[model samples]
Target: MTIFAPTTDSHEQQAPPAARRRRRRVGVMSIVMLAFVALCGYLVGGFLRFTEEVNLLAKPAAFAAADGIVVLTGGAWRIDHAIDLLKEGRGRRLLISGVNPDTSVDALARLTDTDRKWFDCCVDIDYAAQNTVGNAEIAGRWAREQGFRDLILVTSDYHMPRSLIEFDRVGNIRSVTPYAVRRDDLWRGDEMPSAPGLRVLASEYVKLVAARFLSTVGIVAKQSVSTRVADLAE
Candidate 1:
């Protein structure tokens, strides 16, 4: 009877080849799936980000006429809309969070076409916040201190969803009214969207995704250095 025994060398050589082939296939498949998922995410997010709704108005009429207005800064339209509403008597008090410290309050008033007195008395320039999470925390504190139960939250339409998350994360507020600014047609001549405009939208979408991830992991609650200092001073 002839019996065949498998040698160690044969097993080792065959195993390595099969294992390498499997690894290559897995790596290729993983890359393809990851690309597909990323594409899908971007497409869906872009669609939602660009699609403006009739209800883009952040604040309801009743809320707009509330005790105070909280405008989270990012886009130019956000500040413009807030200033317009304030001029129109949307709210008695306005808190413009995420203001640049280098820019004087007087300069901001001039930019918004509001009086210096408004900035001194009614409006607060929050210089601490560097991002949306900071905006929410700082604004939330201001709202609580002012005893404002109802507030008009002003931000861009694309940002409202994420802004709401940050704003609401800090408790002790009655109502948050969203006032989304209407974006102009991003498309240029011939109705073709401008590359710069699309780039801006894409950048914002990326930020939103990052924000969502940070929020999920509770990173949003991590106080910044400025926030800690401010708290300690208080």
Candidate 2:
């Protein structure tokens, strides 16, 4: 008559901690996967937006003269374009920023196929700048030294945005007019991104994002080494 009552709680009570651990691990993995997917989506969206901005950049129909011109060194024909702008009286002076220390004015003249006379008269070399931030600093200092209030900024098509950001932060130069050098064959009206074009744009976008973040954090090159912090006497 001592029959044991069958208990429904036996299996529940015997469930090991291992089962609970498995559930916890699955939850963590799910969260991680979700976060990863979200990050990918964000990056992809940013890339698309970057490309669209580059494509939509308006080419300057005509460039008006400014106080000076700063040409950032990189890309094919950038310096040549700057030289042409200088000859056209777009600016009174030209600072070829981020130039190699070993590069001579004669070499640059030959490279751009411009007369050495122009380099000797109007061109100033900035061998200190090694990056875009440095470019802004060096150019700003030159502008200040020359008592320039407005400057025409010359760079490749994809680089204008970032360069302007740095220039704006410099707080020395009053105005910066962008004169972007765009190759007709590089990109066209809403055309599909080619391999080379996409690669270049993607690289620039990443750099732009990085520069923006650094600026947000108040991280920038030291003024002492690059630019003078003193207010330019108007």
In order, the Cα lDDT scores of the candidates are: 0.71, 0.79
- Per lDDT, the best of the predicted structures is 2
The residue pairs found clashing in candidate 1 are 58-178, 58-179, 58-180, 59-178
lDDT for each residue of candidate 2 in 118-164, tens digit (9 for 90 to 100)? 98788888877778888887787888889998998888888887888
The Cα error of candidate 1 at residue 201, in Å, is 1.2
Clashes per model (N, Cα, C within 3 A): 4, 0
- The residue-by-residue lDDT of candidate 1 on 1-234, one tens digit each, is 998899976775778777868877999999999999998988786656443331244334544387788888777678878877787898888888877667777788788777777676667778787778888877778878888888888887657777877777778777888887645554355333467656655676667677777778887645531642243001
Off by over 4 Å in 1: 1-64, 183-193, 221-234
